[model samples]
Target: MTSFPDPVVLRRGSADPQAPLVVLLHGRGADEASIIGLVDHLPTGPSYVAVRAPIAEGGGYAWFANRGIGRPVAASLAETMAWFETWLDGEYAGRRSVVLVGFSGGAAFAGGLLLAHPGRYAGAAVLHGTLPFDAGVPVTPGRLAGVPVFVAQGDADTVIPRELLDATWAYLTTDAGSLTTTWRDAGGHGVSSGALAALGKWVGER
Candidate 1:
């Protein structure tokens, strides 16, 4: 497995190691600070940690190399996931439960992690983004059976290709056998207040 630097994380709300951990992953061209801000809108029970992506992109960072919006390079995704796992094992090896919340590119990364290690996270929220299709993670039927997933998307999102979004929905709801909560807004490629509220509620219930 490839090794990388420890992730730079922005933490908020609760420092108790035993408390549930909520990891927030930002989109392409964003850093940990960007997603950490969302903590203000999320539920308060769990501790939140926003992790910076390993690869340097335009002016910010990226989780992995991508061919296009919502499309990741298989090799790069695999390497990065391995790097992330190293950090996770070191910092949270025996944690009770961990949840992931991601947006845009980060959503795909979150999906990759959740799909690759179905037993790791308690739940995952994909906000206004597509899953990591063909990104070296197994997408076979029932891979995520019994997993709780929250999928929020913009009905008119043009940034993520329609086919990819449809595929993600189908995989999560059908192939993966995930217990999914879905929300679609009429906006473009951003999360709305309603979606945030719903995400908070969903995480609270987890």
Candidate 2:
């Protein structure tokens, strides 16, 4: 088994141990601090934890090694997933609910987790990133049945390849059988106020 770095977690919201947990993952070349700010735009009931990715990259952090944008190496992804699960199971084994919110590269990581474990998480929000393809996760039809997923994509995004993005949108909406909420913005690779508003509402609903 591959060893991983110790996780760095930043917390916000309620201190109650029983509070529902929301894990926020940042894009590549970013840290926990980058996604922690998103807490201000989301609902207040859950305890939000921004988790820094374990792999160091360009002075920041990455969840896994990748050949290109949205193309994660299978071995690297599996190793990191194991490392994350070790910490996650230890911290939230009996928690009532745990949700994931990820952006860009982090979104792909979030998708990998959801696909790998199926019902492990209550819900997930994928913003501006594609799901992991051919990365050792089952992508069969209805793999995510009953999972509540929110996907927001920028129509003008150039960082990630368009084909990958479209394929992710199709799988999440059609094949995954998830209760999905989708949004398409005319902007670039970042979140917008409208998307955040929709996300806040969706988070509250789930």
Candidate 3:
């Protein structure tokens, strides 16, 4: 129930508010500016927005307090997600086509948002992060039935726990029944050019 300050956002591409909104979420300990560069590699026509997380961590920010890497504290995640949803509703009251693209911790937050309100988003892309698996969201089977989802994971990712990543994969591909798109490789935790290109293609197709 913490009150978060107004969001800080960096926008690129279209200036039209009616344009499709593509939200880019940074990883833990990274600011909006760190992920804003992704706009250059993503699809055009839509507005690409990168918003800074409310909670400060390291020298940057984090979406929620974590019990461990890729493990969000349920209360903290709930509080921050509520704060973010307020901002999102205010900024985009009637707007549609809101797609979430989140990296690392931000990806978990995005997954929380999508899972908590599956009907609210057009699609979500979880890049290099696990979902907020136990953070109070309903991850029951068919939770994301027919929703568009793009998931990119490195088979050798070391930053997020292996079990969490595997569980996320299992949920997205099978249990959730999402129109899931996946790109898995032997890379590590960071995004590669190939992954970015694949993301662009998926976003364009969506």
Candidate 4:
């Protein structure tokens, strides 16, 4: 059985309770330690929090069932979303702004969190990921209405087809209109230095 602690807390960055919170979610098979390295690569102004998924995969962990080549399971997705909602409200009670950073499955979870809550996040950075298209999954217009989102995808991502990437881009950009999509010329399903550089710049500017 997969179990996440009550608080589900993991810290990086300087200890500053008043600092803006930036949550980083890692990809499949990678733990919190994987992407927490981005802390040194991000703007030093925010307090960084890297969270590991609750479920323990054979090699690493996963937010929920991948749901094959279609979409995530509605119930599982809802559970994950609710968990994040409760965590966000509880932990960031009166914080000024919250930034979300996710890669691969982490990106999916981060995107879902913003989609489910909308307008709550100050800004978001989605790396090598896409938004899921499901009937029950929330994608309210006002959710990400004016929120700045930085999306980076590799042109040759074998894991996620170009068609899926384009569809996700269209949905997010058209609906949110505040999304900035960057396409890298790299291959495979991983983050790139260029994407990291762009994310760093976007974090500083946002």
Candidate 5:
């Protein structure tokens, strides 16, 4: 088993033990604190936790090593996913719903986790990120059948490769068989106000 440093976790929202859990994943070269603001923008009733990725890179941290931006290395992703699941299972030791919201590189990690363990998460939000394609895990058609997924992408996002983003959009909306909701605008690589509002609404309903 690969050993990793302790996860740095930032928490917000309801502290109720029975509340649902939302995991926030940050972009590459960013820390957990970078995405903590999302908790305030999201709905109530769910406790939100932002977990720092285990791998250090670019003065921040990353979920896994990648072949290129938005493309993860298969072995690296598998290792980090295993480490995250171990920590999550130990900490969130209940049947409470757990949702994943990831942005950029973190978005790919979020997609990897859901595709690897479809039944484990309540839902997933892919924000400005791509699905980890060939870096392991199954992206086979209908892998997320009946699952709820919220996706938002910038029409002009250049940070992540265009091909990967298109592929992610295509897979999630069609072949993945997820009950997907998508938002696209002329914005660039960052989150937009519209996307945040829609996410809050979606989280509230789900």
Candidate 6:
């Protein structure tokens, strides 16, 4: 297991011990507080726990930073994964399921972890993010089979292109044989009400 430093968690709603579990991850340069704000827009209750990445930046944190699709995954990936594993073990000890949620850089890290350890999560929602790329890392279907995934993207996203998203759709559904995906087509680089609504609906239908 990779070793991750302590993560900052932003608790909200109820502190009830038995609420459904959802782990929210912020994008690069954002803190857990900022990420937790999205919980206001999501279906909230006592069961949510928002976690900030351990990799601290000037004003926020980052799971991992890379130049683009071909760049090397930062050294922090392993440590972050370890940290997440410890958190999951402790937080979901008795829970049957968990929704792993992330945006931007956080989303990419979540995608990597879920893809590599599919059974660890009940489902994953990635907003404006993509699969990770590293020298030895390979995208395999068995890694995420049977998992339900929600991929929300804006058609106008300048950072992650539409073709890349299309390829991701193909890779998860075809190349990796594991997981079903629901995609949203909003037009921008950020999440929108429509996408959130769709995400909420998907969470329910799943």
lDDT of each: 0.90, 0.93, 0.93, 0.75, 0.93, 0.71
> On residues 149-204, what C-alpha lDDT tens digit does candidate 3 reach at each position?
99999988999999999999999999998999999988999888889999999999
- Which residue pairs show backbone clashes in model 5? none
Each prediction's total of clashing residue pairs, residues at least 3 apart in sequence or on different chains, is: 0, 0, 0, 1, 0, 4
Alpha-carbon lDDT of model 1: 0.90
Model 4 RMSD in angstroms: 2.4
In the range 67-153, model 5's lDDT, one tens digit per residue, is 888889999999999999999989889947999999998899999999999999999999999999998899999999999999999
CA error at residue 116 for candidate 4, angstroms: 0.9
- Which 10 residues in a row give candidate 4 its minimum summed lDDT? 1-10
What's the TM-score of every candidate structure? Answer: 0.96, 0.98, 0.98, 0.88, 0.98, 0.85
C-alpha lDDT of candidate 6 relative to the true structure: 0.71
Clashing pairs in 3: none
lDDT of 1 by residue, 1-206 (tens): 55567899889988888889999999999999988988999878788999999999999999999998899999999999888878888987787889999999999999999999999899999988888988789999999999999999888999899999989988887889999999888988888999999999999998
Query: What tens-digit string does per-residue lDDT give for candidate 2 at 1-206?
Result: 67777899999998888889999999999999999999999989889999999999999999999988899999999999899889998987788788999999999999999999978999999999999998888889999999999999998999999999999999999999999999898989999999999999988887
Model 6: residue 127 alpha-carbon error in angstroms:
0.7
Regions of model 4 farther than 4 Å from truth: 1-4, 140-143, 179-183
Q: Residue 177 of model 4: what lDDT?
A: 62
The lDDT, on a scale of 0 to 1, for candidate 3 is 0.93
Candidate 6 residue pairs in clash (backbone atoms < 3 Å):
141-176, 141-177, 145-178, 146-179
